[model samples]
Target: MPIDLSLLDDDQRIAATAPRGPVCILAGAGTGKTRTITYRIAHLIDQGAVSPNKVLAVTFTQRAAGEMRDRLRAMGAVGVQACTFHAAAMRQLRYFWPQVAGDLPWRLLDNKFPLVARAARAAGLSTGKDMVRDLLGEIEWAKSSVIGADEYPQRVAEQRRTPPADADKVAAAYRLYEESKSSPDGMLLDFDDLLLHIAGALENAPAVAEEFRAQYHSFVVDEYQDVTPLQQRVLEGWLGQRDDLTVVGDANQTIYSFTGATPDYLLNFSRTYEHATVVKLQRDYRSTPQITELANTVIGKAVGRAAGTRLHLEGMRPAGPAPTYHSYDDEPTEAREVAAAIRGLIADGVPAREIAVLYRINAQSAALESALADAGIVYQVRGGEGFFHRPEIKEAIAALVRAARRDDLPEDPVAVARAAFAPLGLTRNVPEGAQARERWQTLSALVDLISDIVAGKEAASLVDVLRSLRQRAEAKQAPAVDGVTLASLHAAKGLEWDAVFLVGLVENTLPISYAVKAGTEEIEEERRLFYVGVTRAREHLHLSWALARQEGGRKSRSRSRFLDGIAPDLEVESSPQRLKRARTCRVCGTPLETPADKALARHQSCEPDYNEDAYLALKAWRLETAREAQRPAFMVFSDASLMAITEAMPATPAELLDVPGVGPMKVEAFGPGVLETLAPFRSG
Candidate 1:
């Protein structure tokens, strides 16, 4: 059966078509973009606008691709081409490699470290294993920006403070990378090679390009703002001269600029397409009006940013509460207050899964999780308990030290290693072995020079040597971060949660321990960090920090600056003094009351045995649950929510989240079990 486009509104109708020329759908989060793009592909197949084999749909995530496929079937269409950018590129490169490049190699490398290392060796530079990584990054960034080796200096000169050996360095490495991968020998493809190969195929083989252009005829890209030049070239090849293209993305959500993605692609949509249809999905269904306002305010005024060409959000939802503003004396206090709110919410019937805690860094989760437990909010931390155990961060750390000792450390490796060290209490002063000594030296050198490298530019002083190194060592692949929920700000992109809590908004944490001078690039990234944090919240949002915690009985701490801006009319309070039992009158044997109902209730007997541990535990739990919300936990509840659980004692699934701390998803995941467990005590 043919799919229906008539029922959709104007924006949706344009979104449904197997269009004639280029189309851009500038959608915000929760704007039915996936629906529109999926339906468009289904419509194309049903209308016989393009052959199924020729059609292509590139989404950011694999999960998105799967959902698009399911939606096509539901709409009575099947097997329209759809996949992630990586998956799509791999298919085309594999199919036409022989015709395009003559001979087939086993595979291409994504990391391209080997190529960088080889180039460094050829250049007569003395370096270590990790330099390969930097060279690859430099090449990838250059390639993404569509800057050829000849024109690299003028275009990126301002951007680079500590320049490498001009365009020749990257060009040389790129040539070596090409030789190693496409030399009819190896079978390994790193991430970027997939795109480069397909682009290579299109550029070299005119016939293959024509076939793809004629067959696919139409196109759609999700997160269009994130498209690199390589991706844009591939997209152009797919559509050819035809404007049968539709792109959906928000420049505001352009948080991936560091990865060589540019929102300029989205900004210049009109220039690329003969006729561009621009629409916005600004009517966000995910956040409340309060959250949306904050998002608009923060992003709308972002300075030194390119002006948005044409952007608007329609059909906004009704207003909600003013986002609660709070600032505590330190990380612990902030975490505790956030937990209290979660507890309060659970007590009011919200579920644990419905709340999320956000933060600026991965390292901040330690204090947050600790506080949640103290508050009895059993949250599942993102990626899990053994993050420092990650092979890559540690290896990179160790590798950086080896390289740094040899003067070959890269920024990413050093950053990874340094963050991992704070918790381990590891210091460079005590070098354990050759490996340790090498890593320690690298870290030691970096630490000494970091204050001056306030901007990431100065940090590039060690680039050439490091770039030559990581590229050479292919085995230095860092381990993947693992946890039930994510704990790092870097890993939280393109992801969302039912509830969000952002902890450690202080100047040093969110803005970070790195980046001392706080230049434009670093600050903008920080803003984007906050922007990402804000968008992750679907229903509820929280921001917090700690007052104090005893780590070896040292009580020195500072609160996050982000908390200071919003927490209006700050009130710092302490635990009220406990009543004295010895003040009873002799005639009535009553405790004298100075205030409320004191005279009437004074005759009641005094209770004994204060549960300090229980009270402190509850207090601690409140702070913990409010730092970040990145994962689903076992039993599907947060610790602060559990305190709410203990307090409310609901007897049924229907009554579970009604107890104040529960979230919608948590209720679905563990509502019944939690209810059953607590039902026995309801009668008591």
Candidate 2:
């Protein structure tokens, strides 16, 4: 079948049919880069310029490689090789290892943590899990950048890297790790080693390099912006001075610099191959105009090399709702209110699966998970285990169950639960380090669950509280297939949703403290990350931040500086403008003078006629209803709604619906109970 050029835009068509020496496609977010590249390969095959068997397509992930193969096959272009850099290198290494080393291929190291811990022990360094993980990360960075143990310290200084430990200690650990891997008894090869070994083999072994180079005549590399130095060396070996290559990437999406990946290769492609065909894909088909506009605005503020080459995405879709900005008093309030807004969207007919709540870090998911569960909304965590399935949470639950089985339980279930998690390092102050902080957040969420359970019950026993927890755990075990997605921004890349909530957009969290300290380049990467998060929304985009980490804590946090030009009318507590807009009475429009008036949003003289008995009765009913439903009391009815009910004394369902705060959904849910609560106080 002849390749159809009609399917592609003008730029895509030009890129697909361009002369095949060297081609570069700068694909922005939502651009049809994948389709363009696939069609380009098919077009080349159809034109008899390249054989399908000799074309190798390399991407960043197994999933992406699989998708590429599937698309090529669907387009009637089969026999093309599509795989990740490691996968491609591993195949060649496996074939040549017997000839080169006179032994079976080394067993691939599945988990590096154990090996890293052993290396740490050998080096006389800390063997804690966090330290081990950090050490492994540093080692991987060093190896992937093609820097050996001896050169690690110098490279760290040159790159301005903040090592997990002292530079000398990290170098020692890296040395030990390499020595252990190369020992006679220990034949282990990690993912990075696969590339390093192959690159070396091609450079040293002429027969192996000749055979590998002869196997492929053309190459297509996706996500070229993420190519690390080691991967680039491997690619060069495969090319063997040939320029038959096409690379596709977007510099704005280069968020993995810390992992040794760089956009320099993509940015400097033309410098290496002077005759390369360069094409830019800027038309975005994923999001609406409003979303793309915000995306452009966010990226427009970015500076530095990657940002200088950024593509300004042009949305092809119709206009959508403008992105919203929200400010909350505290983190818990932000989570709860965001959950409430999600529930409202679902009620408005948006599929739960079409929504997402993206945060800056993995630890931020705990509070959001609790809030969604309390709102009776189902959510699945991406790139990590579900809240209940987390190891720490499971351990806490097991401890609680064992304690409940004991006969010497305290009257306060909260006390029992707290004591159960105390051994797990549950404390008022959050611990330092990434792993410890995540553990603390998970345990803190469990404690908060206990408090909510006890608050809802009249006189809850340990057994009853444990049962409720067990029920909640069970519910969280198998989340609904179509549940809201809770993911960190990094995990949310390459995916989009109808409604996206970019929560926890405070300074220390989004740009992050480390990025702030790392200087301008890292800060620019964070800004690009923010741009990535903004583009994930197809229609509704909500960006929110909190004034404080916890309730009653100091309101010292500020919104991310990236939002300075994008979000309108952002008012922090300390802002003089915020102070100027004083609290006012709802009825009289007069500035409130006292704390009582501010709390009530009205002056005492402007207060409506009160009925204490009716108000108390309604409040009791709301509490009982919320307890039975296992929901927050505010979800059932806010205090303002209860006050409106008390003042109106609505006797019928229609009259109850007439209350300002009451809507059709509320009337359908609790109308009869509300009417009965106000029956005796009716004037009629």
Candidate 3:
């Protein structure tokens, strides 16, 4: 039976039906981008345009790939291969290793931390564990960008990145690590080496490359904006000049630039393929109109190169309560209020699991977690020791992976999984406590996936099943357990919850003090990070900042300047003390019903005591002046500038140029209009 295409929106339908060339789907948050990709796959198979077996779908994480496969199966589009970049490369390398070279080198090392530590010690560097970890991370990053140890210093310098204090020592350690990897008796390939080797093989071996491309006729990539340059090169090698590709991502959410991922590829997709079909999915079904507006307004300030024609999202959902903003006297008060709000939300029928508390840095979680615990609320740190990384779970998976290597294909992979976990006190029978039950459920889900793959003929061997499980584990994709989630903004990417508490919106937190000094790129990424956090909310969003915090001692702080960048009309601020007077529209003296109403009124009514007509006239003149100058209206004179102009009633060009954001350059251009616009409000 063919799947129904009627469910998709018109733009989505167009994206799904774009024929066989480079297609870029600019999907915003909650725009059903996933649905479009899955439907496109189903359509390709159902329409006999491409065999399900010949389609290769790639996602950033194993969890995403698994979800895609599940969705495809539901749509009756079976046999499609969905996997992460590393998984795909590993499979190809494993299958063609013999033909390309001789036997494969040493087995894949699961953890490189210990090896790195050993290398550091071998290099006579007695660094702390944290320093060693940082060194190892730098090495991994260098490798991911295809930079070898020899080229590390030069690349670091060119990028303007500060070299490690002990740069030579770290480099020596890195070289030692590389030598250990290529030892005569053994050699090890880490996760990134999988992509690096596969790309190299395809580049050098034309026959292998041709055969691989011929085998997989169609390609679909999810989260394309988070792809690194090396990954893009791999995709190019896989395509081999064939434009049978569909890439979907949001450029505005490109917060992983630090990890070598760039949104340039996604943003420039049309430029790369002149004939590529580009479609924008703007209808956001997740957030309220107020929330969507705030998201759009926040990202609009992004001056980064990747910030293209602001793809503003149109909210399809009904308007909800305006996102609340709060200012606290101290960090403890902020945490307490956030906790109280969570309790209130749960009391109001929002599930605890549906609520999440997000912060800019992991350190901020300490207070929030403490507050939640005091309130008897169960919460899980999103990226901290996920289900697949749990000690017991890792042991069980190791046993299952070993069993999968044996030619004996078990009828019930779930049963094998059960046996593997039995030693760890995890079994098919019901577990005792809530936590145990959850763990058992996660294991059962993993086994069920393997069983389904086997039953559906998606796996040709037990090894393949093992490989799939291992890949998913490495990808850190775990089932969503029932608990309030606490995560850093970076870890919360590609995930959402009902109510989000964006705590720690203070100055040194959001834009972060280090990012402020780092330069424009860092600041831009920080803004993108804030955008990611805001868009994660499907319903209620609360942004909060503390005026003071007590770590060593009470220190005064202010709200982030990024918050200041958000259009004045998007947020309303509040504190413990209620407003002494009723908030009324300054223009008409009407009571403001809500924060959204107040924000709108504030934007509309600048300088309430002054002549209203003068403010309006000044705004009109500023708009016209901006249009004439081919600049944003704010450049001509900010709303604040207009408000000042209306109040001061600057009659002369010199006085008009004295207004904020107006300089000598402005006096040569729009100063006369500024004076003329102010004349109506000026008393002769």
Candidate 4:
């Protein structure tokens, strides 16, 4: 059978037909790398270079592996083993464990959290959920980086990692975790241990290595940039000393560094195998010219190992609309406006499913979910549940339903809901850790929904709110599968849409504050992440950022640095410029002399002489009002507004409206209580 080269581009054809010892295809995003790799496998088989059964193709995901197999089958190249590294390792381990280890293999531990908790107890560390999750992440990173328990502390320091616990404790927990896996009561092997055991087996047993090498004569690794050190060791073990290998990846798409994946192997492939055929596939067929240019610019600024090998993608598609930039006063405004834009795009004949809103983190979805719901738009969150289907939201809804059935039901449904949710960890301050913050955001969204419901219909009871929630959830789960997509940027990789709304582009969120602290390599990875998000767009690309976390908060945030060089008409302030700016007193219009004055934005003498009693009363009233309305207390009236009112002693409606944060709508909603609270402290 003749393998056709007619369908491949020049670069692709070259990569597909390259002579077989060691080949590295530097395939940029949307460059048809998969097709080229499959073609190469078929060509190898057709050329009689390797038997189909003796060729092994490995990728990062099971779906990708399946697709590779499917493609190979379509090309008349069957019997080749296509699977993930873990799958291949597990298969080999299953077959050879009895012969090598003198007994049947241990049960594979599907979830490591329970065992991690046990390990934490043995190590005298905190067993909190977030702590355990972080520790598990650390242990996995250490294992993937090929660092042993004894070396974990030094590695943590070298890597400048902010571990969940002290380095010694984390290492202790890791050691205990390893010990527990082999204990008499606990005969378990985790996913990481699979690769380790297999590598160890091959290293210790020459006969096993010989048999394994003889089993697979040729190998193809996809997404080679994401191969961890541990996976690399297993690959090395499998190869013995053979160099008949093909690795295809884009160094710019190397965004999984936190998972211990690195691009060193892919970048250094030619150096490692001096005669390896290195082919660069630069033409991007997924995005438009505007998008490709943006993607190139994003990665062009990267300054690290990946930068040296970054592929300058050429857009193969026709020119499209220039990417748009947006700035918002606050996050809610950003989400609302972005959702509105998505709705408008859908109205302009774009299919709802063809538009997506991507953000930096999972917690960012809660606001977008609310705004989309408010706009009467349907959406599905990719790589996660729709907002209503989240565990925290479901738990909150159940609690609300339980409260609705109470015999001593309060007049205010919001109060009943708050009292019910309080025990479940609903708080004013957002919790630490990604998992906990996401949970808090979900609960907070629920509270916001209840507020909206009650505000829309003053007569709505606790039962009515629950009914509304149920209706919303049902609507989301309806047969309309063409809803818009809401996803995190990381989740949006390898996915494309006609229109993309890249929201939450603020400095702290995108580069993310921690990435900034982690030094240049992490920052470069963040840049590549932005490039990945940008390349995900086919035509319409809308980038946006907000200046504040909440509606009335100070406009203190800056747009992501990745956007500084790309976005037009935007003057981004450098760190030095931002720091050098003077803080002036809001009351006197003069420079602040002290840190406290600067923080308060007012001098001591210029500060408003507010009535403390009246301010306290207003706070209490705000809390009760928030509970009754099923809203965050800050939404009722920020403490600043309360203080302003007490100081100004707003006696009439007009005066109350003059105070900051006290708008007409708020004055109309809770005016009576606010005025009443200030009455006792009024000056004669």
Report the number of the highest-TM-score candidate: 4
Give candidate 4 regions above 4 Å deviation.
Answer: 374-376, 395-434, 437-474, 478-480, 550-554, 570-608, 611-684
- Candidate 1 Cα deviation (angstroms), residue 372: 3.6
lDDT of each: 0.58, 0.85, 0.76, 0.83
User: Would you estimate the TM-scores of all the predictions?
Assistant: 0.64, 0.78, 0.69, 0.81
Worst 10 residues of 4 by lDDT: 571-580
Kindly list the per-residue Cα lDDT of model 1 for residues 1-684, writing each as its tens digit: 767667555677766773545678877765667777777777777777776666677888887788887887688666577799889888878887778756646564545555667776775542354344455666667767776656766666656522334455656655665556543354566777677778877877788898777667667788888888788888776665667777888776676665678788788888866467666556676677777766665555555554444243332556655565555654445665777777777777767656666665444554455445556665654533322333434554464445455432224433433433433333423432223333343344333223223233434533433443333222222234321243566567767766677776655556654432437766666766777777776656666554333212122344544444445544532312212244553236656665432422233354312322332343344344333344333234554456556665566654553554354455665566565555445554
Better of 1 and 3 by TM-score: 3
RMSD of 2: 14.4
In candidate 4, position 221 carries an lDDT of 97
Q: Candidate 2, which segments miss by more than 4 Å at Cα?
A: 395-471, 478-480, 570-684
lDDT by residue (tens digit), candidate 2, 285-331: 99998889989989998888876677999999998888899998878
Scanning candidate 2 in windows of ten residues, the lowest lDDT window is 427-436
- Quote the lDDT for 98 in model 2: 71
Write model 4 residue lDDT over 408-461, tens digit each, in one string.
Answer: 545566656655665565654565455555566667656765765676683378
The numbered model that scores best in lDDT is 2
TM-score of 3: 0.69
Question: How well does candidate 1 score on lDDT at residue 678?
Answer: 53
What's the true lDDT of residue 321 in model 3? 88
